[model samples]
Target chain A: MTRIACRQLAPRIGDLPFNRELSAAAIRDAAGADVIVLPELVTSGYMFASPAEAAAVAVRPDHPLFAEWAAAAGDAVVIGGFCERGDDGLLYNSAAVVDRGGVRAVYRKTHLWDAEKSVFTPGDRPPPVVRTSAGPIGVLICYDLEFPEMTRLLALGGAHLIAAPVNWPLVERPPGERPPETVIAMAAARVNRTFIACCDRAGTERGQEWTLGTAIISPDGQVLAEAGEGAQATADVDLLLARSKALNSRNDVLADRRPDLYSPLLHRRAPS
Target chain B: MTRIACRQLAPRIGDLPFNRELSAAAIRDAAGADVIVLPELVTSGYMFASPAEAAAVAVRPDHPLFAEWAAAAGDAVVIGGFCERGDDGLLYNSAAVVDRGGVRAVYRKTHLWDAEKSVFTPGDRPPPVVRTSAGPIGVLICYDLEFPEMTRLLALGGAHLIAAPVNWPLVERPPGERPPETVIAMAAARVNRTFIACCDRAGTERGQEWTLGTAIISPDGQVLAEAGEGAQATADVDLLLARSKALNSRNDVLADRRPDLYSPLLHRRAPS
Candidate 1:
């Protein structure tokens, strides 16, 4: 069985060593798995006290912890998020897909959320779907999943699965309701017809807790597997089923799109 | 007979008199109706050349079109989108629920799409359900429907029917597939367990042409009724049946939710 895992991580803000140790340990625990994903910016948590703090925690790819993770998870392909210094000397919210062969690929999020916009410039363009030992993998940080167009593009590029690393905040629209995380996971899964494995960080980051909805949403929009509330959880996924759904006809939101018209909308100036 | 007229209209963006006149004419064509609904942002076009151009068309309770539309519709209650100058002096993408007594309630969109952020701010808050001639009517703009919380709030607040006006862009993701608008509509209707009257503007606008697949989605996530391909459409709603469905305990997403966990997630901050 080609098993994929989405592991919920618990990281303290600004505690890079603790987060890195946790991630390395988790990768070790997920040994022999075909693939694994972790939450976005987990190396430095969701937010930093200032740019200096962020820069200090954001180590270079050559940093020892990353190499340790790659060596530890050498048996399985791993994808995780970290803060990287771009060539332009700016910081980027990047996802690094790796194997024992060093970094397999890197994807910088094209769409930046509110505070993110101030910290990082949007990426130049979306990365192409990369072939993996398990399947074709496409990686997006948080916020990118909400834009159907971005995911649709990845689907068109023949990605069998989409891996997202999110730090979903706690929300309560009703005294009780479906968390936005579940909805987004469900929507992404249904539209792309691909396995969506997202690692959501858990625990309270100074009273602002995350909904640790570590979930593996199926192509049919079912939560095939999910972890428990709070800190850590893991899910198992059958990679083949994800590809089958990607190739399926009826519900393929990407395959069904009339791109001729939308490509224009993708540009800054969409038609009225 | 409790007749409701759900017409798909393409009122000129920001042309108040033209929009009112177009609706009045439709109302005349379907006289003795209990309700009338127009397209999303019907008061203004989807893309505004500038914020001022968009705001130039907004209206409030004292606007002349409000009285004119209510009177012209005679006994029918009208729901449609218009620009409203909010308390903060900014404009909102608002929908006015008008009846003989005047404007019953107004709902601004909770979730603003890409370009909309440049012009309109998100509605101050989720609105309370308003009692309508047919039953309790809840109002939300287009993107708001995408956020499940918007619908859940109204459903929890006792809304049996939801009226949404939308300006959907035309796009071809697949060679021969239905537009995203159709799929989203069905998804919203099914998830909310309320009859969805979605009036969408068809045809090309300013620079972007749109796919005109307007329809009324049923509580079961099916397109109960659909319109033709262009700037006009309509569908009849059976309020009694929808109410009965909501009342029943079977097959409703609303009843199946695990509210305890969801409430915290709904109001949570966006993922970092």
Candidate 2:
């Protein structure tokens, strides 16, 4: 079993020092968790006005802020998004996987959402499935969860648990229902038979409203724990519960895939 | 706008003539729909005890039963599943796209569900994108809907509406909530920006319970129409609602895909 904690904090844009302090406090408070996930761009915030504005707040993996995060992580693994300043001096919307030892892996956001394309370069490489004391954890940032291919690839790569750091903008929906992002996440967990921890930023950023809080879904698409708007959420889950992808004795979800029929999905040109 | 109807009827196993009559009557009741979808294996029913028993109930495309279905279709296009006796003389759990003119296209079930592999031959080719007066309709049967690749392929192949014929057995879930199948369909529709019409069967067949209803989901993931257990469902939807896959000004869902990084998904080797 793995104890997962989520810090759904609202960060002010360009307020690096304040955001770092907030993150450190949250990590320290979430003690005894095997893994703690924080929202996307928690350090720099979302809704960057311009490329220069975004680049201004970006930091390298070796930044002093990560040391605090690592120390706060204690014996746990922490996965959270940040504004990354790459070696090539380019800006990226990235997530760092940090443990007691140090930062283990970094994943740049692959499928940039609206307006993000103008500022950040899309990550060319697939996100890594980092092996941890708890289990294998795969990371995805915000809109990357909308693409099934992203989760599918991670599951194929042996990810038992997917950690998502999202800055979810609230879309219009009828009263008393989950957001589309939550719905999509639930479906992803069910289809892949993998546990998913989605940490979303709360409160409005600039004028855009965020779908605040977090959703921890089990392999069977059950909501283990979910926080309401502007609330923190956490869940203790059995990681080995997702080891079996079988829906029934005769039907194994992953083994039933017909790769031959899925060839059209790989082609650059759309199938006619 | 296109008016769509679904006939959620329960067919007794191996009862070909009675099933054909029931389908025709329902099509007549639907009256003025642009398209009507029916449940999987509507003719032969699901849960076959043996191959010979299933083959006994299967019919060829040119069989007289299709003539009645085509006539009952009126001016509307009908998408319904049947036990198909293929040209190779093998039985296939198949769906036929029929209209007033005749049968337009036939799609064999690609991913066989539990126990089905023993009786039916899986289809080799991808499901067709048949052009209709309302829009292009892509076909998938039952378990195929569980695979995100199937829906993504149809969307990439230029389908605006996906017609699903399903024989959904009720899975374990909390009482008084939507089934996981419905959740997956809603997510598929939203991610693909494609309207989905799922026609599911009702009642029990050989002690196995059925989901027994229908769900009509809009491109935005809203349930335009839904039916309770054993009830008929219908909705009038604008086909052009799916013309734009763009969620916002800058992000077109299909175009936003990074195909370059998805190559690992095409490999036949299951990653450890």
TM-score of each: 0.55, 0.97
User: On a 0 to 100 scale, what is the lDDT of residue B65 in model 2?
Assistant: 80
lDDT tens string, model 2, A5-82? 887888889999999998888899899888999999999999999999999899999998999999998999999999
Error of 1 at A40 (Å): 0.9
Candidate number with greatest TM-score: 2
lDDT of 1 by residue, B123-204 (tens): 6566546887778888877766654445555655667778887777765454443455565555555555677777777546
Please provide, for model 1 over A209-268, each residue's C-alpha lDDT reduced to its tens digit, 9 standing for 90 to 100.
Answer: 777777777776666667764333445667666554333232234332323322322232
Q: How much is the lDDT of residue A232 in candidate 1?
A: 39
List candidate 2 stretches off by more than 4 Å.
Answer: A266-272, B266-269
Where does candidate 2 chain A have its weakest 10-residue lDDT segment? A263-272
Error of 1 at B11 (Å): 28
Candidate 1 residue spans exceeding 4 A from truth: A229-232, A244-252, A266-271, B1-272
Evaluate residue B258 in candidate 1 and report its C-alpha lDDT on the 0 to 100 scale.
34
